[model samples]
Target chain A: MAVTKPITRFTLFGGVVVLLLCLSVFPSSGQAPKNKDLVHVEAYASHKRVNSGKSFHIIITANIKQGFHINSHKPLDEFLLPTVLRFNETKGIAFGSVCYPKPKQVLFPFSPNHLSVYDGKISIFAEGKVSRNISSGDINVSGIFTYQACNDQMCFMPESVGFDIPLKIVKAD
Target chain B: MVAVGGFLIGIILFAQVANHVHKIFDPLQIKNLVSVKQLFSAKIPEGVPVKLPDLIITTIEGEQLVLKELTSRNRLVVVNFWASWCSPCVEEMPHFEKINRDYQNKNVTFLGIATKDLLSVVRKFIVQKEITYKIAMDDQDKIANAFGGVKVLPTTIFIDNNNRIVKIHKGYLSQRELDENLKDLLH
Candidate 1:
């Protein structure tokens, strides 16, 4: 019984060391899964370099997975979830209305009415203006693109894929 | 050496506790904390009975039939409106088949209406999916519009023996949900 107390303390110290070793060996293994592969997004700026206070277009091209289509930003049905783009507030940047390409009218076999949907590739354009006071350098304007994709037979869970648009703010001529 | 043995036992006990905690607090299970009905935003009719719509559709087999003709057989009719491109609609087909098989002898009918789909695609999909229930194609979208304008995929309508619509279930229905919805029809 006398030796049991020292043994407990010794075991505790050893357990702590083993736990630390395990953590060091497998860093980032316990993190929550990331959003990948469901949908691919590519951001583009109309002009790589724009004068301060001048407006430019940021185009986001979303390529849906093969055999799948996402509902248009303005879905014909009220119940259907529409694709939406939300921009995060950033300093020295002013964003305008986002314009989405018109959806192709698809009349599925199950319904007589045509649905508003986008398949393969769809582009969303956003107008942005750099602040006059901003310095001449590259800056990123990030945002989220959310959509629900469905193939010929089933609807997948909705996903929000993040996107970043890089633009260079040059001094006015 | 005895002290080391005691430490090993303590480690095992701690491991067991951690596992139990993980099971109890699994976030994946908690992600769907909202009610099942919240999955869709559609305004579905519940319990309030309505008469079956008078609409005819052509089956993929090229046979023309009215939906009520099947309902008039004095059995509970489950009309599911689905499309080949609708993912949720495809996912629930197997469950519908299983339930259809179980109620083979019972006075029940499962009718799947393929709307806005091509006949070639529907024929190909049925063979690939091995669908066993009755499938009809509404190429003209007449049947869909008759059923209160089926705007959503996987909209299931339940009609009683009296040819009255007992309920309209919108969205995907799990096995348990199917069973729950057919309680009046089966039992």
Candidate 2:
């Protein structure tokens, strides 16, 4: 038994090295908190007139995973943070007000007691008026979105998301 | 004596291992420590008085309360916007309650407004938390909009005697922050 002491120490050292190596090799996947949870955005036009001076619509949607809900554009309590969407206006392009979808009420253990939020998916619609004199072709619209996602346990810090949508413009009738 | 020494060493090792495991599992503690450090080190914006939009809300007792009325008593009004489902709001309630009690006679008034929430829930939360400060329900979120549209839970607006907005704090404020704000306002 006395002769085996050095061998045991070597085994312990080897085990620690293997554990460290495994930890270093397997980097964590930077997935959003919930599995299969992600936010998606899309753009559409009421009329396909993709012409200069034509009005187009952009709808940004966030699809939450099952059993999870995102904070509402307007939370129930004044102290609860409200979700905000930011847009950068481009030359010759005019952006309209953002229309937020209605949120559902939720209950939790925290104070003033209940909150309002959107579960599964929600959409924000905005109208963009194209420039009247632009040469017909592909037009790019872009903006940044800043919002905070929260669960029953905690609220994540606000995250900024940038998106660009391309549209085909032609002559308006 | 040797056995006792060995037992103590084993306990020490067990404690160390347990602590390491706990640290790995508890990310909330790390987040909280970072927030605490930010609270202590961040530059606190200076309190400035600005006129706020007028708002009226209904109290739990079914009385109409106007924002302007709070300014009549030459009091420093602390308006805390909170909901029952916000953890930071819950954590900070006791501190506000304490401040309300400690400065009751010091011309300081604390008003808690529940925005975008049901009145019943706000009433229950107030009762459960043993909050003695005046609490009102902003059914339409009008009050919140008047306060520059709060972007976070536990956002507190400090109003001076003249009903001017003196400070706007966003996020879960520590007792220390509240104490300092109160000290500046009270004096």
Candidate 3:
């Protein structure tokens, strides 16, 4: 394993998850403790290859790490940051509206109202249609998932995870 | 008959929404549960104190506070980054308020900085919690990024008399820890 200065890089699925640890702040004698990840996201297309003019759903799944939760796309509270996903349109690909799963509400000691959040595995689906003009090849549909993850007591900074769903286009027979 | 059916469906939907909000009405069940609290915090080792830049921060009440003026004349400054949405930050706020009250006119100033939070929410929170210490907003996380990007909530930075950041504590710090850190800085 190649060791990099300061930053310890880990490859999650196909993306590089760069976690800036607080180890550098501690003394040399202090042992570094393992911190938990707030959330993990991965995405894939319903059909790896699709016929021209055919439609498919792009599935994006976010797994909230144990002991953490992220606000839903439509958080019930006005003060909360809503989780959002944006697909960067590529050539010959038409994107449709993305669907977000309903969030679970949990009552904690902090707030008087129940907080709408996503825990465990939650998937967001987006519809995409392939254009008839594209030739048979691989095309990358890039998107970014933005969320603010929080545990029972504290919340981490808002983060955006970028992903790509590659699809192969075949001419309609 | 149609009205009755619509009312029944509405009741069912309301029940489903209520079920999602897990509220334990039975206080007797609390004994069976174990409270688990986890935090990743560490002590900052002695290093070269970074020269912290002075900036202007506007409070929710439309007042401005300058970092350079607060740190002038060898005064110690405590800047705590917190948000109303963060429960741990709310829990740790009282300790800072206590310390802020204790350090009045003692060459120590405690300023609570809010980032990624709503002004109205913060205002309601302060009033509800009776927070009297000077508080301000760090727009676009400018102050947080300046202090090396506070990734976690309730991150506290201590600046000594020399206008340099001396220590940084991450995560929930208890009142005892706050007292200990202050004792070290004072003497």
Candidate 4:
């Protein structure tokens, strides 16, 4: 009986080791889906302080989710909503035409035609001028970034992200 | 060892307890779990049987539809997932309508499902575009998500009289592709 005891223990340990190996091979079915956000927008002015009546640059960057893309400012498809950026009328700042970044033309598996789209991250630049009549003080300028994000298969609803940029006004340099 | 056996038993007991809790408290989640299971098991088959749950759809024409019921009645169902904002979807809709008309006497039902679209906007757009097929809004996007997440607009799924989904085409279907696919699947 004593001699058989070691063999019994060895057999039990072998069974446990085999079970552990099988369990490790067939792991859990992956994490549950979280309705993750698709896009984030950030904006900043070129200079910390710009003199009144002088021109400064406003740079805006859109970070799109990995699998999604947005139509360019000038998309080839007429029906697609093009990304548009515009600043609201403000007392301190006035804007000029925006310079949109170049877009990648991709022929998706689901598209018959190649689409001009912006993916990953893209930066947009615009020239803003401080009003000559405005006093030297901190000013807030609001703007909107509008886009429709889509993956290869479906497009999300068109949405807009608003940005408020603060500028420090000073005498002309 | 006893410890290993206990661990295995614990996992089994925990799963059983969670299943019972869901059955008692949240029946809707239990229903969704079935769909999720079916989704993984199903592949858009060119030959094999594609099994799906009987999901309810309320069309714009105010008629309720059950996909399994329609297929069981010796009718083929063509479901197109589309949106008003999808340009390719809009472009190919007229072609879909023409094919729909061609199969008037045939045992085929064409349902245009507008996904991620406002009901009012879709109604107005369809009227302006002269779409005559049965239209419905997938407001919650549950229908599209079931058919392998319809990652593209203008995806088409064909269910046969046996209630098996035979084909799922993702992308714009030209008139020729639409006609050929319908003909091939019909016979």
Backbone clashes under 3 angstroms, per model: 24, 14, 0, 3
Worst 10 residues of 4 chain A by lDDT: A27-36
lDDT string for model 2 (A101-152, tens) is 8888877544356677777767788888888887777766788765556655
**Model 1, chain A: how large is the TM-score?**
0.72
Listed in order, the DockQ scores are 0.07, 0.04, 0.15, 0.29
Candidate 3 per-residue lDDT, tens place, B22-85, comes to 2222222222223421111222333322676777777777887777777885467899999876
Instruction: Give one digit per residue, the lDDT tens place, for model 4 in B1-187.
Output: 9989978876875565554344333432232233555433223422223566777888988899887787787467999998887766877899989988888898788899998788888888889889999999988878876665655677788877666566667667778878977776665
Report the lDDT tens digits of candidate 4 across residue range A25-44.
Answer: 65334221122378788999
Candidate number of the best DockQ: 4
True contacts kept of each: 0.13, 0.06, 0.40, 0.25
lDDT of 1 by residue, B77-121 (tens): 898988776656866888899989988887788889987677788
Q: What lDDT does candidate 3 reach at residue B25?
A: 20
Q: What's model 1's lDDT at B116? A: 66
Q: Second chain TM-score per prediction?
A: 0.70, 0.70, 0.72, 0.73
List per-candidate RMSD values in Å.
16.0, 15.3, 21.3, 8.1
Docking outcome class, model 1: incorrect
lDDT of 3 by residue, A10-125 (tens): 24311211111222243344222222366778999989889989999989999888878888898775556789999997888899998999889888655556888899999999
Report the candidate with higher TM-score, 2 versus 3. 3
Candidate 1 residue spans exceeding 4 A from truth:
A1-58, A61-173, B1-49
Q: In model 4, state the lDDT of residue A23.
A: 45
The numbered model that scores best in TM-score is 3
